[model samples]
Target: MFGFSIQKLLFTVAVIAAVWYGFKWVGRMKKVREREARERLRRQAGNGGGGGTGESGESGAGGSVSGVAEEMVECPACGAFVAATGAKSCGKEECPFLG
Candidate 1:
């Protein structure tokens, strides 16, 4: 027979653990949200008006680099973005990225 005392002890431990984890999780999430909000507010204030910064600044602007991003290909069967070199032609089915 399962004793009530043992069951009660386990239940108490479970409840305490649940409450502790919930609090920690919520606190972490709150910090993340606050940080994001502050960054957004700062960016908005700096740019003036409520609108976000117009066009993000690229790190290597106008710097000529032979990168893979420059090479792009459009599937003939489906208008999905794919790499130019080794992309298989979608003959029958539409590409997942497009859908």
Candidate 2:
């Protein structure tokens, strides 16, 4: 025979509540992380767009910042891919764009 006791019912309810709240907490944390990432990206873009004294030590005409995607071009002679904005020489005689 199956017995349905008040303690069993209460324990089941507590477990359900704990799981529900745990999922909610996890969701909240994920949202917070995503918001922080977006804010960080926004700040980087704002600071990177303004031409400064190059304190970050990033070498480029535009002072390119990390995490930003750049257009790539394939080298005709070496068959290597390089950034289109500041393509460097592949050290080959036929390579275009001076090193």
Candidate 3:
């Protein structure tokens, strides 16, 4: 009787392992589908001319240098933002944003 019970226990263990592996496979498939859907959406929006990154305008009295990032520095004196390369803290010594 004990030997018969042991055989049945072994069969149950095998069945449980198979079910766990099957569920794991299904989860992986679902994740792949979600990733593809997001990529497609990104591509469609990009082709529709929704935005421009890495873009700059010609430099004049008030223009960003061509092909250069417009860097702005925050003033610690008055909280005003200014261009990093040519910015002074408003020359206001009393300003909290002074830096």
Q: Please provide TM-scores, in order, for all candidate models, with all chains considered together.
A: 0.46, 0.50, 0.46
Candidate 1 local lDDT, 1-99, one digit each (tens): 369889999999999999999999999999999999998886665564334536443455896654224477776667766776667656556553322
* CA RMSD per model (angstroms): 13.3, 8.2, 10.3
Q: Which candidate is the best by lDDT?
A: 2
Runs in model 3 lying further than 4 Å from the true structure = 50-99
> For every model in order, what is the number of clashing pairs?
0, 0, 7
- For model 2, how does the per-residue alpha-carbon lDDT over 1-99 read when each residue is reduced to its tens digit? 135687788889999999999999999999999999997886676575566554443235675555557888999999999999889998999999797
| Candidate 2, residue 82: how far the Cα is off, in Å | 2.3
Candidate 1 Cα misplacement greater than 4 A, ranges: 49-99
Instruction: Give candidate 1's whole-model lDDT.
Output: 0.70
lDDT of every model, 2 decimals: 0.70, 0.81, 0.70
Clashing pairs in 3: 76-96, 76-97, 76-98, 77-96, 77-97, 77-98, 78-97
Shift in Å, residue 10, candidate 3: 1.2
| Candidate 3 per-residue lDDT over residues 1-99, each given as its tens digit | 999999999999999999999999999999999999987785664454435663222225575444334588777767888877756667778654434
Cα deviation of 15 in candidate 2 (Å)?
A: 2.0
Among all windows of 10 consecutive residues in model 2, the one with the lowest summed lDDT is 52-61
Error of 1 at 19 (Å): 0.2
Evaluated at residue 72, the lDDT of candidate 2 is: 84
